[model samples]
Target: MDQTTLNYIVVGLSFALYFGIAIWARAGSTGEFYAAGRGVHPVLNGMATGADWMSAASFISMAGLIAFTGYDNSTFLMGWTGGYVLLAMLLAPYLRKFGKYTVPEFIGDRFYSTAARVVAVICLIVISVTYVIGQMTGVGVTFARFLEVDVTTGLLIGSAVVFVYAVLGGMKGITYTQVAQYCVLITAYTIPAIFISIALTGNAIPPLGLFGDHTESGLPLLTKLDQVVTDLGFASYTGHHSNTFNMFLFTMSLMIGTAGLPHVIIRFFTVPKVADARWSAGWALVFIALLYLTAPAVGAMARLNIMDTIQTGEVGSPEGNLLYAERPQWIKNWEETGLLSFEDKNGDGRIQFYNDKNADFASKAEEFGWAGNELTVNRDILVLANPEIAQLPGWVIALVAAGGLAAALSTAAGLLLAISSAISHDLVKSVFNPEISEKGELMTARIAMTGAILLATYLGLNPPGFAAQTVALAFGLAAASIFPALMMGIFSKRINSKGAIAGMLVGLVLTVGYVFTYLGMFFIPGTNILPNTPDNWLFGISPASFGTVGAVFNFLAAYVVSMQTEEPPQEIQDLVESVRVPRGAGGATGH
Candidate 1:
């Protein structure tokens, strides 16, 4: 069968499986819809969490960032992985023990104020909606290429599929469906890595292959990559080029953001016991490691392949560049999607893929009669196109298409559920309509999810940045606003409702104001107050790294507000103390 037909069949089968799971595990009650009735096995919950945690940022854009920027982007790997550790170690078990359906519920009860809960709901909505935009972008990119549709139509189709399953299954449906998605995505991710690893380094393990010698050049894989990129006037593949302080802040933001993310924290609420939450976190780390370890190798190998294809001979030679007419099939397929393009800037028929912004490189390029960089490849397309660029089988390419969609859809479902629960359970039911029936809340949850998906889809069409960069902004927002509130709610009994609310407002306003000044208000283009450059950043801190600074302000504001007000009531303090203790530890073994 043709590759296009294979893609349709594979993606169709995956969608059918998701729909089947959603139908079978459809939620029946508010408890089931919000927390899967708290019956998920630790191992199973772990697998589901893995799927939920590894969104389009992890699967699609992460390696692409690593491929283009090399070691400077390692913050993505460290921050995300380390952030899960922070979640598992610091937040999951305690939050699960608090026995709340949602993060806002925990915050409201702990702070003893509806206002705290409402603020949390707002934070959840903002963080989740921002996060969902990245997933929708990934979905649109995948569908546009594989389904041969425009990005807008592809996003609508993907949105409809998500609405059917996510709105139907809620947490129960999403949890089980995510397990199946984990299987599909991991298989899709690793198979290509293994294939490319063996092809390039003659090694079967991709992570090890990254450090192993390249079979073609007899040099270490990273060493050869450094050589190839430097020859094209790009930074060395393994060099660190970003500001150290900014990298520290960015990584810390991701770590705290991971712990604060409502969708991920709510996954812990699905397991039956508090101990099960910790166990699930452990299992999730194992599953997540499978992909995280493979990502660097995939990035390096894909970069090497692109360089080799473009510079078939010596870098500066007249015959080095690939002819536009004879470009590879993978390039042609991607070009059709409009994500990858080549322009003959110097009227040369050959494609030049070099850094034209480097003044030193411009002199060398002029010697070769090259006008400017001719190829424009979107960073998000590297992984999806990797198998094709390597000439993998039709089935492998189709599988990757399925995997990308699975990664995007799984996390989108989780985020939408978080948003849905916050609106129906936290806002409408808790604050506005306390007498809301269970059935009414469930319907509201579904409706909220539909609205959230629509908003996400609309914003995704005009994303402010690449998928991973967009995700990073979401992380920064969560880090600044939610992380401080959750951490203080659990660890400090002196923090009152007023303090919690004050902290969230301070963090949210500061981070959002900083980001809007550069990225545009609500990320609408042409609305930015300043150019988003290092020179324009405050104290050399980029918008993506400003979350840590915001968190510090949150901490200080909460502390100051609490000192001026009364401490939390005695019972609320005791409740905080009780959650810290492991009440159901012994019972977890019996299960």
Candidate 2:
């Protein structure tokens, strides 16, 4: 059978399972819809959180980024994983003890200000909406590549699937569906890595295989990879080439942003108690690390594999390179998607995949009669094509298609829930219609989900950035606007409502302004005031890294404003103290 047919079968079966689970576990009440009735077990919640947290960026694009950028991109792995430790220790327990349905609800109540809640709802909507664009785009691209449909058709199909589950079951349906998604994605990710590892290094374990000896070269896997890439005029595989200051700040931004994201923070509210929230954070990290640890290894191995395939033998010899006519089926397939291209700049009929701008390597290429590099491989193709590159079985390739969809769908559902809850619970019911009935709220939440899905689908067709880059922006906004407010609410008793509100607005405006100056105004075409490059950046910090500066501004602004404003009410002070202690904490009741 053809590989595409197998992919359709595997992906179809997985979607069937997800849709079935959503139907079986359909939500019945506002409480269940919003917080799963606050009855989820810690481990199961952790698994669900894992699936929710690892979006298309983590599953589909991260390793590819790492593959192309080398050690400089290690920020993604370290920042994303390290933030969980901070989340577990600083944020999760207290938030669970307070027992709120949404992140904005906690912010509003803690500050005792309706205006503060409204600001938070706006921030939550912006961040979640930005994050969902990447997921919806991933769904479109994955279906387009595997299911052989146009991107618009794939997006409609993916959105329909998410709507059936998320709108029907709410958080209750999403949680169980996410558990199954976690299983599918992890299995799909690991099996290919294991096969590739064994193929390259005679080791089944991917992490260990990354450091193990390469079976063909009698050298360590990384050592062989470094040598191969350097020979092709690229930087060494393990070397750091970015400005140190920018790298550090970018890593810190992603870490802070990871902890602050409303979708992730809301996961803690689903668990039964404060203790479960704490334990659940740790378990979520454990599950996340399973893929995280394997990603770098896959990146290193896949890079080596691609270089080896093209070079064939010596880099500067006539008999060494793979001719264009001899390109593999995987190369041909990806070329059809317009993501992989070869120009043959030297017109030698044989592909030359290298960094042509290396002045030091120019003489060597001239001797080999090569003009410039010819092959252009999109980073997102590495993982999806890895199994084929390694000549793995057809089933493994099918599993990869299903896995990417699972990761994207699970995260989209979680973000939509956060958006819908913010609209219904925090904005509409709290402020506009306090007398709204439970049934009415439920109907509104589903309606909100449907609207959010439509918006996300339209935006997905024209994403502001690639999968991972767009996600990083979402994290930056979350860090600047939401995280500082939450930490101050729990840790400081003097942060007044006015101070909190001012800080969030300042952070949100500054971070977004800096981002739009380079990424285009509201991400529309022909609207950017400046080019997005390191030389033009302030102190060489990318817009994505500006979140760190924005967050610092939030902290200082809030503190300065609090000093000039009236202190919070004594009763609000006592509520802060009550949430800090874990004793006497019961199941979260209504707001």
Candidate 3:
């Protein structure tokens, strides 16, 4: 069968499976809808968490970032992985022990303030909505290429699919659906990595192959990659070229953000017991490691393959460039999606893929009669196109299409759940209508999810950055606003309602203000106060790294405000102590 047909069948079947799971596991009550009735097995919850946690950012964009920027982008890997560890170790069990349906519920009860809960809901909505934009972008990218549709249509289709399963199943349906998605995405990701690894390094394990000698050059894989990219005036694959302070801050932001993310933290609420939550976190790490470990290898190998394709011979040789007329079928297929294109800047009828911005390469490019960089390849396409670039079988390519969709859809469902629950459970039921019926609450949750998906789809069409960068911004927001509040609520007895509210507002406003100043107000085009360049950043901190700084301000503001005011009530202090200790190991209670 043709590749396009195969892609349709594979992606269609995956959608069928997700819809089937949602139907089978349809939530029957508010408890089931919000927390899956707290019955998920630890291992199963871990698998589901893995699918939820490894969104388009991890599956579709991290490696692409690594491939293009080299080691400077490794912060994505370190930050995300380390952040999961921080979440699992420091937050999951305690939050689960507290026995809340949502993060806002926990914050509200812990702080003994309705205002605190409302603020948390706002933060959750903002963080989740921003994060969902990235997932929707991935969805649009995958569908545009595989389904041969425009990005807007693709996003609408993907949104429809998510709406059916997520709104119907709620967390109950999404948890089980995510487990199936985890299977599909992991298989799709690793199979291509293993194939490419063996092809390039003659090793079966991708991570091992990354350090092994390249089959073609007999040099270490990274060493060969460095030589190839440097020959084209790009930075070395293994070199660190970013500011150390920024890298540290970025990593810390991701770590705290992981712990703070409402979708991920809520996953712990699905398991039956505190012990189960811990086990779920551990198992999740294992499942996440499978993909994280393979990502660097995939990035390095994909980069080398791209360079090899463009520079078919020695770099700087006029005859070395690949002829545009003879470009591979993969390039043509991607071009149809508008994510990859070639322009003959020099009218040389050949493609030039190099660092044209490198001034040192200018004279040499003039010597070679090259005008400028002629290939425009979006980083998000690298993984989806990797198998095709390597001439893998039609089925493998189709599987990758399915995997990318699964990764995006799974996380989208999770985030939508967080958004909906924050609205229905935290906002309407808790604040507006204190006596909302269970059925009314469930319907409200589904409606909230639908609205959230619509908003996400609309914003995704005009994303401020690539999938991963947008996600990184979401992480920074969460880190600044949510993580500090949760940490202090659990660890400190003196933090009062006023303190929590003050800290969250400060963190949220500062981070959002800084991000908007550069990324555009509300991420709308032409609204930015300054250019989003390195030189324009504050204290050399990129917007993506400013979350840690925001988090620090959150901590300071809370501490200062709390000491100047009254301490939390005695019962609130006891609640904090109980949440931290394991004496009363009981089942989670619903609000």
- The C-alpha stretches of model 2 lying farther than 4 A from their native spots are 586-591
TM-score for each of the candidates: 0.99, 0.98, 0.99
Let me know the TM-score candidate 2 reaches against the reference structure. 0.98
How does each model score on lDDT?
0.93, 0.91, 0.93
Sort by lDDT, top down from the best: 1, 3, 2
Clashing pairs in 2: none
- Give per-residue CA lDDT, model 1, range 376-442, as digits (tens): 9999999999999999998999999999999999999999999999999999999999999999999
Candidate 2, residues 429-506, lDDT tens digits: the string is 999999999999999999999999999999998877668888988988988999999999998999999999999999
Clashing pairs in 1: none
lDDT of 3 by residue, 473-527 (tens): 9999999999999999888989999999999999999999999998898787689
Lowest summed lDDT across 10 adjacent residues in model 1 is found at 582-591
Clashes of each: 0, 0, 1
- Model 2 is weakest, by summed lDDT over 10 consecutive residues, at 582-591
11 Cα displacement, candidate 3 (Å): 0.8
Question: In candidate 2, residue 431 scores what lDDT?
Answer: 98
